[model samples]
Target: MSYSPTIYKFADGGGAPVAPEMALVRAVLEPHDVGDPQLTVGEDGSLRFWIRASDDSEAEISADETGILVERPQTGGVFAIVAELVTKLGAVIIDPASGRAVCRAEEQTRLPADMREEAIVIDMTGDALEAALLGPRIAVGPSPRAAR
Candidate 1:
């Protein structure tokens, strides 16, 4: 069967779409553990992540200036990560095919098993998170997940 991409985006902050800010990016990714193909965010405001399901299906995530696009999200981990980040960033999960918000920010969505233990949802203020990002050691824990 064919599959559609899933998108995670910020609710219109103004009259326009908003991309994720650095702190939001850090908050969402720093404590996340995606195993081998960990999510990578570029200094230029780009992101890339690949997900491989237990069923052997694979998906790729791409980001534009507006939001994150998950291509062919065949795994629950895909939504798990999205749910985590959506809650953290105050964003929402968009069903690309329908162009609707399936999951709203801060809503209690369940995490998939593969991600339940690995995912560490953040509760830091922007100033605190920024501080942790700059310091020799992070307050959250070990250094934020390697971007590489």
Candidate 2:
């Protein structure tokens, strides 16, 4: 069976499509002990994951061609996880507020100067997830009774 996130739409009636990039993002996030991860697609084709940022606050990480967008009521603890994801995906975090690359300075060079000023760009292609989909499959040999 394949993994697909439950789809949802914004109040504005816009929603994103299910894309392979989301699977890659989920693959990168699966091993973490972070709160139960919930994936959602936005109207603009952005994939987002929701998690608890704190006892009282919620956070969301949205990924698109531009990169990932980290949104939280408070960025304190959530930023660490965002940073880790940036590193794992060979991407960079861009602070939308300041319009600057805030983490993974080395990866900043990968994005065009214009995009660097916008979204947090995770430098991953859908190809990054090709391996995850190729899990080992069991061969269906003849049933025991049939063999007998």
Candidate 3:
């Protein structure tokens, strides 16, 4: 008998496609521990585009120490958004601000230069998460047992 892996991509209601701002907020804040001086995600989409953080395990985070807990925004995209947020907020300060500090992929610069430090700055501990959510991630295959 022969078996072959298959790939499938699909979208869902998924509790309403989180708004761009909210998605960015989620991507930005979902990477820190509780009460870790970081913002959090709220239920009511009142102001989705605020900021937040998390503190997952080493294996569960990106190199930049972001999230791998509750999946939402695309890993790389999330990381880009967060990195950009960090850069904007002066978190990962890169005096040069070149190379990985900023990528030349996204159309409009991911993070702006006016991101308020008060808006960002959470305690998302770990590097995997940072890598997974705030580093350079590339889209790959879909899950074999996804709820699509």
Q: Pick the candidate with the highest TM-score.
A: 1
lDDT of 2: 0.43
Candidate 2 lDDT for residue 20: 27
The positional error of residue 108 in candidate 1, measured at the CA in angstroms, is 14
Deviation in Å, model 1, residue 110 alpha carbon: 22
lDDT of 2 by residue, 1-148 (tens): 3222111111111222122256567665444334443436567766666654344334555567644555542323444444445456654443333444433335545555554455333333222211122222356788999978
Query: On a 0 to 1 TM-score scale, where does candidate 2 land against the true structure?
Result: 0.45
Model 3 misses residue 5 by how many Å? 33
Candidate 1 collision pairs:
none
By lDDT, highest first, what's the ranking?
Answer: 1, 2, 3
> Which tens-of-lDDT digit does each residue in 1-148 have in candidate 1?
4445443443333433466664665555444434343437666767765655444445565665777765665443444555555556665444444443443323213333332343323443322222222223334545556543
Query: Residue 117 in candidate 1 has what lDDT?
Result: 40
Clashes of 3: 30
Cα shift from native, residue 36, model 2 (Å): 9.2
lDDT by residue (1-148, candidate 3, tens digit) is 2111111111131211112333443454454323333224334432222223332221112221221122233323334344454333323322121212222223113334332221223343333324423453466787877847
**Model 3 residue 141 distance off true place after TM-score fit, in angstroms:** 8.2
What residue runs in model 3 are displaced by over 4 Å at the alpha carbon? 1-46, 50-71, 92-148
C-alpha lDDT score of every prediction, in listed order: 0.47, 0.43, 0.30
Return the TM-score for each candidate structure.
0.49, 0.45, 0.21
